[model samples]
Target: MLQHLKDHSNHEALQLQLFASTGEGITLYELESGKETFPFYLTKGTYYIRIFSNDQPMKYSFTSSFSKGDNFENELNNTKSTAKLMIPNTTFTGTLNDGGYDNQFADVDVYKFEL
Candidate 1:
């Protein structure tokens, strides 16, 4: 597919990553300021997203076509032991940062709900 990439940061380099609940990860896309962007796919079942930006003060907007995301996620919930407790139907949002200097990137974040 062919599409124009949006440059909210003067074409600063950017990356959009995808991770499956099973911990499967594959680089789906990189949308730079002035290039064409190809759409990526996400097969069903709990997914995680990580956005990396070369732009220091990166600014972007994300909207889901379907109501499948929460509005808040607590940080450091990157492991099973650190899993964040989730309340049913409540909105939660979180950010996954770049594997800066140490490359100690938290590849996945999990949330749990107790019955």
Candidate 2:
């Protein structure tokens, strides 16, 4: 049977809470390895996450953060290779700099801590 909710789900909130585990590590929901849905938690404030990868077959590292201001880059990497991120509290505009470009394409995965 299916369950019903009291109100429509928040799209942005749901995205922030998504995660994927790849045995080695965890990653965002959209980047998960397998076709299974993983669970994560989300709060009404700032959050940070880091992604690590194996080097034997590949090499890369990923670190990303989300907050409620224009200083998004301050919480993340200061390099060229980066990923697209949305600042959680201020209208969801702008991109965050996630360190390590190669990491994004590696076999690395992601996990959520506090959700």
Candidate 3:
């Protein structure tokens, strides 16, 4: 599963959008700011997503039955535990997992937005 966050300090309504590689592409989960959990179907491939908002210190998390890729060969490098991928003008905290496999990995995150 893939997770994304916005700048928590922005004080704006943020939308979390995610796509599963095995099931859908548009968005498997969509939620407003401060939502704890969002359920979505996961495919057996790479996935993509897009997050919108302008808040700093945002947080996110996800769960799926997919697997991680060889890229995570280094256990320490892999963010198995809850990770907070901080973005410019934003702070993000979330949990990402591959469900214990080596065939799926969601979008780690490209460019965070500020709107």
Candidate 4:
């Protein structure tokens, strides 16, 4: 299960908290080899995810499959005004600290797509 989860780029979060899932279990995961995953045993229903941290910056990505994708490019995109344009149905990788980190503020990445 762990191996399957890590393979999906979409299965990631930083110190994540999952709740109100369709089951009786919520697993905690941290970044390992650029991926994070949880137990994938549950019914299809409403789910809640909450991410909070005082020390570590949040980093996350998602992909439908583990087979193909492109690595995220770092371009100082910290706001909506400077959001990186993305291609539809394409996958990319990135991290919070990739931009830069400051104890006073966490790094933020912004992306946008056309209609």
My TM-score estimates for the predictions, one after another, are: 0.40, 0.19, 0.30, 0.34
Please state the error at residue 96 of candidate 3 in Å.
22
How many angstroms is residue 10 displaced in model 3 relative to the true structure, after the best TM-score fit?
9.0
What are the per-residue Cα lDDT tens digits for candidate 4 across 1-95?
12222343444334544455554324334444355444332234566655443334444454322323344545467888998789887776665
User: How high a TM-score does candidate 3 get?
Assistant: 0.30
Best-matching candidate per lDDT: 1
Give one digit per residue, the lDDT tens place, for model 2 in 75-114: 1223333332443444323232122233654332221122
- Model 2 has an lDDT value of 0.29
- Tell me, by TM-score, which candidate is best: 1
Candidate 1 — which residues are off by over 4 angstroms? Answer: 1-11, 34-40, 66-115
What is candidate 3's lDDT per residue for 29-94, written digit by digit as tens?
334544455443342456665555556555666554644332221212244353323346543333
Task: Rate residue 30 of model 4 by lDDT.
Answer: 45
The lDDT values for all models are: 0.57, 0.29, 0.43, 0.48
User: Model 3 shows how many backbone clashes?
Assistant: 13
Error of 3 at 20 (Å): 6.0
Q: What lDDT would candidate 3 get against the real structure? A: 0.43
Better of 1 and 3 by TM-score: 1
Query: What is the per-residue lDDT of model 1 for residues 16-61, given as tens digits with 9 covering 90 to 100?
Result: 6667687756444566654453333333458777777766666555
> Looking at candidate 4, what is the lDDT of residue 91?
75
